[model samples]
Target chain A: MSSIIISENDFLKFKEYFYRKTGMLFEDSKRYFVDKRLIERIEATESDNFRSYFNTLRFEASGDELQQLVNAMTVNETYFFREEYQFKCLVNSMLDEITHKKKDNSPIRIWSVPSASGEEPYSIAIYLLEHWSGIDKWDVEIMSSDIDTKIVAQAKRGHYSPRSVMNLSKPILDKYFIPQGGGYQICEDLRQAVEFSRVNIMEPADVRTFRNIDVIFCRNLLIYFDDTSRRQAAEMFFDSMKAGGFICLGHSESMSRISSLFRVRKFPEAIVYQKPLEAL
Target chain B: MAFIKKQTSQVINEDERKTPRDFNGLCVELNHEDSKVRRWAVRDLAEQLNASSVLVTRLEHEDDASVRTAILNALAKLGDTIAMNGLVACLRSEEAALRNEAIEILKELPYEVEPIIDGLLTDADSDVRIFAVNILESLRHQHVEQWLIGVIEKDPHVNVCSTALDLLSEVGSELAIPAIEKLKARFPDEPYVCFSADLALKRIEEGSR
Candidate 1:
């Protein structure tokens, strides 16, 4: 029951600032939703008004408040086959092109980062099994990483809440998962198929070992990083990739905003970025 | 299963990492014949506090775009006086890409860049002044609108004022309205300025209401 009111100008200020900091843009339709969250954060941070809260959000050295705001604003929940079109892109377009262009029969490598409890890497495995015909022909390496050790451990455990697996059809669920602790436990094969490691993508040492990657699913994570970190992340990925490798960002995130190193590649399933074939 | 595990333990062979890894070795490698070797040296150099001046020197001669990027990131990581001044020097470089790269790094270092921004704005080089305004375009400092107002109010170059005015359109407020109105009169013959200033003025008036 505080009397803090967000004026029209205040909302505009917050909207532009938030969009610039994080790539996520809130439309006019999300105004009520945005304002409510802003008020909640205002109250939580004990700021006198929107202006003070915004100042701290922008200038706070630790950047905890901005991170908190990103978490509150973004729907960060991950599930099986989330943004599955990119998987379709993988099976239909990316893998085919990769296998064809590859001179040697080296394993095609795929990296999924911010493993976020393994749904994505697991989903990639499941998608290749269910949809990709070349799964039988080519050797594929799937590596998944997360900044949080706890999340990395959780990802390796391969357990999922009911909500996490809600997108999976019952038949696929039955085939790939077992009921455990009133939740779904991913089968041993899928878990073993992926190599999960703890990695802070920002730390060069953590990511230096991930090299020659072919397709990278780095969705929904860069939106949380500040501008410099995002560019550095792009640079790290650029170095990690082989020439002509593909990168799939979150639907909202674009390499165009981050750096000019990658080329925009449009596929029927989803648009992706590519390290130019000529780049060393 | 076609899906393999633990297959990539980096492609870099242990024997290939034979470059001397100490600070002096990295400085020498920064001038190595291979661009990749030089890039790796830049990355490793970024970890050392004393490496900034060397990085600044290497960045001067590093022609490869990727190597330049690594050097820029390393300098930004150091975030010291030498690092900041080196980036400012890039702002005056004849190469457009180098200038743009410097702007990108400067935009992220508000605390480091804040002390130098006023001097940059008032610098004799109009293009350098324009680049300074470009840094202000995304600079998160609280005084961005004010700095931009100063440019529009005093910076004699039309293109520089016009650049400041363009950014002012997005971030300007009632405080900027007077300066922007005077800018329109100051550049009476400049059609683009008059139009955008009116547009910014209208938006501010509407937004404040």
Candidate 2:
């Protein structure tokens, strides 16, 4: 066992640095989470103490370690169809608009901005396959992205443990996923529906890569950001969407407080927004 | 079906058959010609069983609308983000009912819904637009304030504009005060906007006090 003891000052330093770099606000109460995750990092790195690990993180490297630090710090607790109503809205309302907006040969694009562990994007693939009959008529592309490279790699594998399939229905299980030795593998068709990549929501990137997206599903991940970061991230989503494109959020997320470019729509239990047909 | 039968002998008794594989055979029934079989299979597979590759594949190819809806519902119950892209594709179906069902599933996962909500706001269908607004209000989102203000400032539809005003009042933040002031200045004839502005101002004063 690595005898790495994290001090209060170390926790504070990480909190401040993480807040500054990633805009993830960690209060004093999160000392335990910080200490626990960093201790694991220290053990993995084979460092004897917290000071050496902290020093290496601070000085002996570029920003690569920062990502592992952030990954260790982040809580990636997510599951398939975690919120049922929102997916209903995506299939019911948003899909109709995309179908209406598409030209005969135009490819419909979708970006899952924080496509954690591939579940969200794969869920989307399952929805498309189940509902849309004229699949070959449209060129459909689903781009699933995340900031954590480790999670991105894991997501790309398209495999899940038995525990990970707890929420999945048997019919859906039998249809879209195949059983591997100890885990489940998403079917090739659903797996092929989306292309996964590593992306930081906060950093500047080639928006054109996500261009012409008819809809984007960036659910639940924004709560980790501060107000300014949220605003900036929302703007990025706005810029990335095509005219009259749609954005779907987590059940608890709303744009009412941050942006003016989108038109808010309501369903009984779901909320979706659309970019204006023209620029705001 | 074969896997389940082979594994059943490993179980000591019928009551002890709790593994996810017990429910594995339903995916074949999900696409059967009989609607009842398909529906039953979907229900059993989606609610009780672990995700199976075969079932997901069959449901993905099932031609019947009801069967498809059942499959989507089952996927939603599973909450697996892996199916998100497919669910998103389902949102583009020509049938309004099918599309609506897909949106309903997306609405349940707020964390996964935020980025997609912005795209949904500009949908040509008024009902879809309204659904986006309701979701935003529930999420207490700060990002939509600016867009809501713009809607109030210029949306051709009266209901859309009014909904924007209502949302601004509900948010009750100082950031909206400027937008409300502008609405009051430009849309002076619109009493609802004026009323909302006044109410927001009153709320701001009370908060400060």
Candidate 3:
């Protein structure tokens, strides 16, 4: 409701409440964004007031409703191959080194956190299949996780709106996705390649369950977290990754502000974070 | 008669002697260094059903995760109001992890937790209030909408107001229009609140229509 005036004190409380729950910082500059979502929920619940609703959110056990609130607040605007350079880097250099370093034919694990409706992971699968020539010899395991159950469900179904695939070349689209209804459904083989799970990185328990990740694609999600949350998240990533693992973040995000746990590795194509093999 | 008494004594084993049967003994066992002993004590305490206070206290200081979990299970099984108290204390905690864990426990017994919901709503800490409201989110009773609306009109906290309004938007009727309009009037500078109230009013109008 445009008329719902949130006082500065209330805004601060919301900021704290949201940060504690989701670890995402709602800064003063993002007031408009936060306010719009908060208003929508206020109306959705039909609560006579804000205080009670906050109480409900704080104490609710299932976390389903809070997840719904998070989903409403977040904007997942992603497309296939949104950043071309990263894919190029992955195909040209990263894979060669990773594959060469392997003693046996152990599967290379790639994690895509906040996989946002399946596009990114599927894009990865497609890229690996098309560009990486040695796919037959090595096993490629992709695990994708998102906080939003609704989005995760969408990711599992492997159907895409035309807008989601706008960046894909026609040949790639013809080979990988089958045209069904108005949107294209990803082929069964590619769909099955990526495993999807609902995970919130803010929760320590949830992050601890993930282990031995070779590479993590956590692009664009860190910008939402506060400094403390970002550090915690960075540590979680570091813990989850195997030694010599690589982390690719959004172009805007840097690990320096969050933590020094990850070392900056400047690749010709993109800057990424790496867990040193020598360091614990 | 002496020979028969000696035979009875011989039949009585050390295992039975060691196991805690009384409340005092079990309470002592709860603090045992060995987790298995503590777990056994927790389970037996649940069977006793009257040792809820001791179990709740042990749940607070218990270092072993399994032992703490066992204590929680025992308290839940006891179904005493004391268990509810333990959970409410967790709601008051500053630690989000503990608060979340308490919420999970309280979620199992929504009916038992209903009475304290109001107290939690009025808690000094905003986080506590938020957690209390979260407990209410699971309940879809007829009175829940009224309770939420009440919070909207009375609660001084903005997060609380926003939370209640969010619930009201889903559960409110045309009757809530006046209160929403009043909310809009109260905060002319808050465009988001104003916009939310306007939207809620529209939804109410639409639902009535």
- Second chain TM-score per prediction? 0.94, 0.57, 0.75
C-alpha lDDT values of all predictions: 0.87, 0.64, 0.71
Q: Top DockQ: which candidate number?
A: 1
Top TM-score: which candidate number?
1
**What TM-score do all the candidates reach, one by one?**
0.90, 0.44, 0.45
Taking all chains together, the TM-score of candidate 1 against the true structure is: 0.90
Residue by residue across A110-228, what tens digits does model 2's lDDT show?
78878778988877777666665545466677788888999889888889887777888899999988999888998876766677777887664433245556788887676555433
lDDT of 1 by residue, A138-239 (tens): 988999999889999999999999999999999999999999999999999998999999888888778878878899999999988887889889889988
CAPRI verdict (incorrect, acceptable, medium, high) for model 1: acceptable
Taking the tens digit of each residue's C-alpha lDDT, what string does model 1 give over B1-209? 88778644555642224676899998888888877788778888888999999999988888777788888988998999999999999998999988998898898888998899999999999999999999987776888889999999999999999999988877776899999989999999999999999988876776555
Where does model 1 exceed 4 Å of error? A1-13, A46-64, B7-11, B14-16, B169-178, B189-209
Model 1 preserves the real interface contacts to a fraction of 0.46
Ranking by lDDT: 1, 3, 2
lDDT of residue B166 for candidate 3: 68
Rate residue A50 of model 3 by lDDT: 57
Q: Which scores better on DockQ, 1 or 2?
A: 1
- Candidate 1 chain B: worst 10 consecutive residues by lDDT? B8-17
Q: State the lDDT of candidate 3 residue by residue for A176-225, as single tens digits.
A: 88999999999988877888888999775565457667789998887666
